[model samples]
Target: MPPNPDLRQTIDVAPGLDLAATLGPLRLGVSDPCWRVEASGPWWWATRTPAGPLTVHLVPGAGVVGVEAWGEGVEWLPRHLGRLLGLDADGPPAARTELVRALAQRVPGFRVAGHGRVADAAIDGICRRGVSAFEAARSWLLMVEAMGDDAPGPGGLRLPPAPRRVASCDPYELHVMGLEQGRADEVRRVASHASRLEAGTHDGGAEAIAHLAGIAGIGTDAVEHARAVALGDPDAVPVLDAHRTAAVVRALWTGAGADDTVDVRSLLEPHRPERGLLVRLIALVEAADAADDDGGLTP
Candidate 1:
């Protein structure tokens, strides 16, 4: 694909913003082919959009993010860069405790990335229910490898299968990809109604969440996750994961066992609009600590 010079643009970013740190959590894992982070250069992302297949190279400058794109969806990237970089965030909330203050200071560059793709977030959230992270990632990788198309860029990337295609897939085919029958059906249900969901996401606010939650197989948990990732609702608290809950509690309460639903909300309330980003950062820190304990092998 030839680069679209006319589509390229740069937007100013806040100081101390580490582009990698800001966007790293968006990847399913280190080996996620759709989102690539270079060791010393621009980040590459490939996705299927309403316009068409898009590949973007995001280069970070001293106080800006340079975006270059190719393909039919070229205009989407530049227009949505602010959401992607969490530019609208109110930053750290007033820290009521030293722990909260330290967390904010330690990862000042952290930001919640908004992909603005409801189908993608919905599919991911569905696959993750009642499963380990490894299992969810594996299932997603298998489905993408089986049904996705080649991306319009280098690195042999592939875009996730379009919602219509997923909506049409047979449950048996998805079952072969390691999804349970129930989950497979849920995926199909969400995909079949993806257009409506996407439209609702554009409308934004509680209506979108309500519309998504009203769908069969989608619960509050999935809605929360989708809101955070697809809609860029920084206040969206994800469904409770034991590890993530434990991590947060340990960070704040030292010897606490784990965070209950109410406890988690209370802990994050101080951060307000940046709560989702902060939660993700705490998870990242916990994952790093686990890696260290396992002698650098990620759990």
Candidate 2:
């Protein structure tokens, strides 16, 4: 395979960036790259970087998968992993709609084109097990640094852990990284089968979700999220997320009680295969609102 590209960049997010407020909803940081959902200028974006301004972009065919970008480092993150950032891997119809629509609205000029690695997606699921986005990201940062490949960049940040690494981690060690005993055990269990998954055993995103649910601590929501990130299951909607659920409620019924729209199955009815798109639309709307709070970008 051809070597990956150099996608690292160095744009600054001006002065009005809010770490917690902007990324409070989704668990972006719960994996190797450590994602942070952000918005800059007219575009609401999500990224993974320790510092610098956010700049989301799309790059095709890097390494064995596509690359996605965000942050100054994106001007320069090796091309291999960068392309995965904006990956819109095939998923259920509903999921595709949600991701596409969300990206269109949030990332302006964004396009879903590229392949992503299954291994990265699996690790992302483990880090996100039953926690807030911040919690997941923090945990992921710790895990990736603790056990991952040496990243080929200035900071020396490690690449995400390999499948065997995840499978081999002892339960005790996992707890140290904030994972409960059961959750830790689940990570190891899933890791053992990571190779099988890496082989592309599952048929569709639904099959992938089913496999994820078979692992411990992973339910429908976790399964869906993992599929989206790992298997590129566009139709996989993270129905279990609080913000997504709340957004769905608001979109369907402006003044309705939150409880009225809590049913994920129903909320996704209209979009069918593109259920995730509805949630993403709501999420973009919310992200855009927050970005507007500071009188838009300084530019």
Candidate 3:
């Protein structure tokens, strides 16, 4: 028999609180083992919490979102569910700026995703450092299947390797999953301090990012990426690599070389208080536009 949910909670929703838009950032790709979505239906998420593994199903409809979760970690999922559902996210205030005003038109009532498990997100973020999303997603899946446990319920899901498990990994093992030596060591370093990292997660983004940045191999960009993916924090500094920086510069500005040397943080300053959410929104729109241009999804 399929496992029954150990707990159930119905979260009230605001209009236009889209499941796809709110939770999209947590998913590395369509094949991400940590998540599952049915056609026009609820999505499943298998997560590794501090307590243990959890499987969650979210059903979205008018003025409400229903959540059901099971497994050893169900108890810990509730307090953090609000953070994950975009409910706790700061909404656009009066739309004073052009960016805010335009976002109001394009994706209304959108919420950024919050990853409740800081260490798990950090691990996945490490996998993503200096690589393509496809590579990151694939490496994450393989690493989980090879070292993690099966999640309860359906969708054949698996959680990311636990913090203790990651902490114990030999660099060569993670290397087999496509993590270079530096990232592999970084993974272990972060996982070794998993307790402290998780303890400080609630201390806010700056503190958490500062802690992560001090680690030998981890960069501020990766930490910010983890913060965005892990916390859905609106305050997170955006991760701007050369390619993404160029894309933003071209799409948003006219003259490039002279005026826009690097100074990404300065350019993005105006969007503060909502910078992380804004970056996610732009990516979502760009991805949709690309799909539409390519004849859209095929059956």
Candidate 4:
């Protein structure tokens, strides 16, 4: 029987969110086809199927309250999605020191927390490689809706898909999702072994990276990205990509320097052992809607 789709109920969109800016960029401004989110907190959008475009916006501190679905069950949002999307209510220490200070100065909504989402991070990395941000987001929507599990949250909304289910997906299925074979293969490979690597933040930082890197299509940058989802390891520097790199430079040096040629290690040297924390702190501070530009100073 086809799974029922109207099982979600009760979502409290957290107060104090600047929906206009945050939701737009965070959700790639509707660039992703499978999912479309509104600029309202605690709002819900139903999918054509349990696996189709499902969007949920809850209060900053709000959580799941109820759920009801057709095809499969829905409960608990995926940890990985939270990590990549910066949805976790809590924050973690930065990987670099200067990042800690810089973040302390910029990026208001950023937080420091352990890794949250495993599958989303892996799939996002693969699908995004060599593609435009819009293309990657679209591919993600296609891939997840096709293979992901439905978990109920605060309003009975199903969370992103599960790793086990994703691992078993066929390449052709991803093609149906509008994804090419190579990206699909990468997603499968990462999802296949997600369990071994999804070992919570405080526990599996280094090990998870090594394991993720072992998969085909995954590289140093990919592994670091996974670590961010898995452990929220603040130090998981994404030095490979151009956009993130540019963001890093701009956030770090306040310059619109080219990301392609920048060196991650050299840039992060200022923070040393605590670079990750600093970077995230900067992001968090910058994300804040109301800021004095003094970077929250007591002076």
Q: Pick the candidate with the highest TM-score.
A: 3
- The predicted structure with the larger TM-score, 1 or 3, is 3
Task: Please provide, for model 1 over 1-299, each residue's C-alpha lDDT reduced to its tens digit, 9 standing for 90 to 100.
Answer: 65344367888877667776667666565666678878785788888777788887888888788887777877666656666777755454345556546765666776666777766777777777777667777888887887788787564577876777888988998998778888898888888876666523345535655677898776667788888777777668765456667677666553445345337677777777667766777876676677889999856
For model 4, give the RMSD to the true fold. 7.8
Q: Give the number of colliding residue pairs in candidate 2.
A: 44
For candidate 1, which ten residues in a row score worst on lDDT? Answer: 253-262
Q: On lDDT, who's better, 3 or 4?
A: 3
Index of the highest-lDDT prediction? 3
Cα lDDT, model 1, residue 24: 68
Q: lDDT per prediction?
A: 0.71, 0.48, 0.73, 0.49
Candidate 4 similarity to native, TM-score: 0.59
State residue 37's C-alpha deviation in candidate 2, in Å.
11
Model 2, TM vs. native = 0.61
lDDT of 2 by residue, 237-274 (tens): 64343555556666665344446536657756766665
Candidate 2 wrongly placed segments (more than 4 Å): 1-27, 30-108, 113-115, 153-156, 199-218, 258-261, 297-299
Give TM-scores for every candidate, taking all chains together and pairing residue i with residue i.
Answer: 0.84, 0.61, 0.87, 0.59
lDDT of model 2 at residue 294?
Answer: 62
Better of 2 and 4 by TM-score: 2
Model 4 residue 13 CA deviation (Å) reads 17
What is the alpha-carbon lDDT of model 4 when measured against the actual structure?
Answer: 0.49
- Ten-residue region with minimum lDDT total, candidate 2: 58-67
Instruction: Give candidate 2's error at residue 75 in angstroms.
Output: 22
